[model samples]
Target: MSADKTILIAGTYDTKDDELSYLADCIRGQGGGVLTMDVSVLGDPKAPTDVSKHDVAQVGGSSIEAAIDSGDENVAMQIMAKGAAAMAAQLHSEGKIDGAIVLGGTMGTDLALDLCSALPLGVPKFVVSTVSFSAMLPPERLAADIQMILWAGGLYGLNSVCKSSLSQAAGAVLGAARAVEPPKRDRPLIGMTSFGKTILHYMVKLKPALEQRGYEVAVFHATGMGGRAFESLAEQGAFACVMDFATQEVGNHMMGSGISAGADRMTNAGLKGIPQMVAPACYDLVDLIGWQPLPDRLQGREAHAHNRLLTSVLLSTEERREVARLMADKLSTATGPTTFLLPNQGGNEWDRPGAPLHDAEGLAAFCSEMRAACPANVTLEDLDCHINDDAFSEQVLAIFDQWVAEGIVPEGVS
Candidate 1:
């Protein structure tokens, strides 16, 4: 941190006053500046804050006098959270801070969540929470790319445990802000989705092909959390075009699997009107469990474990067709040029001939339903090759080239 980047320190200062002050001094010791925002509900902070509780509460449509006089703890915290987010966001926009760190037990964690999400991507958002990376905190609740560390033994005071977590978190934020260089936006970026390389190898072919055409490429794996990040960034208009080749998260969500990426899995890029081509990659099997023992509830359909955390279970023809209809329904609302690529031979690795999960009838049922349900405003292409086939990659590149030539995609320099 030779440039001395400013790090925003936000928390319930009344409860964690000594902790927050120690953190500020630690960061300042590392040659980084600090901006403090107090989000305490009832009491006053021992440390001075750039944004005071009175100002923050007023900004969040509440008065400190009212909050202190009469209110529920949760309601007061909510008001403070809103105010902290507003003040933090304004500071960030004015370039007063390069990154932010928020510390909390539970209420503080909830308050920090809002402040973290309020800041945009590329700002180092970190949370030192007692519930760091807990299953209770869903990926959607945190901003994309937020880093979290467990606040071990940090419930009450400044012990060795608190010092260790705070010290590491302070260093982590500075390291992130200093090391990250802005992206080279010389070319239009194309986002491509994939799963295991064995299943969605077209990612490899698509990347170089798009780069050859003077476009940049970003690939997102189709895991549950990965899907959320991809969708969130797309909503921010990060990509000029998207090759949505691996869409299993949608089916996973429909099946109520833990591998779900929420209900809007396959709709973000379409809603943003970015030129996009979608394929049925990895839609063959719903992810169940990995190397772990299969729960009795997940019995049937030729389950196979891919790795420690990925188990695939086959979907019947009717189930596959139903997902296809749902997907087409979502695509029908696209506001920009969209293409649904139907790879007639197969969709996922398990759908090929002689594979344990292969179901020709299921694939055919999906194709029929998809083609019939596709909107007339959207384009549909039926290809004879499998999703991972070389021909599929070729077709995607060709479509991208045509989109660029027609000015549907802005021409990007290498």
Candidate 2:
């Protein structure tokens, strides 16, 4: 490939010479630049390349000989991942790379995925690998960001089958680079969370209001993965502020509910130093698949059968206190502006008066405990309104606006 639209082709150059060369030719035919980097442990590279063993060792901090001598796959994998990331970062800084492509077997796939993850989201990055058809952990982690995996069947060298796959992979990266536009940020990006029950409320008022105010609101369903996706974007600097309403997932995390957002859901915004407006929007209960399928320990608890497929188990005073403490601790780390608004009347639709699981005492205890544990920088406000109420939404928006005006949000953040 000509050294002209920069593309970094990384792989075990000793093993996949034909496939790498074919891909390089395809890239050059499309008028793209190519820089081949040899990631092989052995000294002999079958193909001609710009970056060699010395360059890889200098960037990766470990020689291939050391990695091979150790005979530990995990350690070698880690070293390769670090090396690829460093090289990718250096290329990105030099503004020489328009995209990147990697061809490898299972180990190669893992290394490529790690390097892709290191690049900022939206960069065109692809991997042609033998393990792509399987549900691999690396691809799952790099979803929609920078990694695209093309499954090449069989473990052997790049035969006819592998060559075709590599060609298609090359085309994909070039296509993506030509078609994708750098993200435009004319409006502030607001992160919001919702569940099936609250989707109507959000669509009707909250989303529209934010959009009308020159903000791009991204609504994530509070499923197990949905919460994590939102947090990932926040960490990648995709959001200007957050409106975390469906915090019910935290209850799942605390009570072993099936819909837990792992432990990293609520802390991303805080760690990223983004201004956030939080609420116990649906933390009154933990969600389960169905009332009949409830665990034996949860059998006697009051439950709300929201649908045939979903049920919510009410939290006791003690459980509510625990949840509140968890929320407080998570929010306490906020380095930027933050406000935890409590809907005193109820937390969710089922927490209202006359609801079977409604318990004023439990809610009161949660509010008090959370307030006590919250950091001095985080302001706690108790609004005498339901979470879905227009007034409550407006109050939260006003607080966000105040923070923005005070320069709490970093300057130049849309």
Local distance difference test values of all predictions, in order: 0.84, 0.75
> What residue pairs are clashing in model 1?
none
Q: Give lDDT tens digits, candidate 2, residues 1-414.
A: 354467889987777776788888888888877888877765457656898755776688987777788889778766777788788878887897878888888778778877786777667888777776454442135533555565555366657776677778877888777776866776778888887654226435778766766677778887666786677787777888888877878888788766656677788888888888888877778888773578887888998777786788887888989999888888888887788998777776667778676788988888888878878888888888877677787887678667767877433323
> For model 1, how does the per-residue alpha-carbon lDDT over 215-251 read when each residue is reduced to its tens digit?
8888888888888778877888889998888898889
Error of 1 at 227 (Å): 1.2
Q: Candidate 1, overall lDDT? A: 0.84
**Among these predicted structures, which one has the highest TM-score?**
1
Q: Which numbered prediction scores highest in lDDT against the true structure? A: 1
Which regions of candidate 2 deviate over 4 angstroms? 1-5, 15-32, 42-44, 65-71, 104-106, 128-144, 150-154, 159-167, 186-188, 195-200, 211-214, 221-225, 248-262, 284-321, 346-369, 410-414
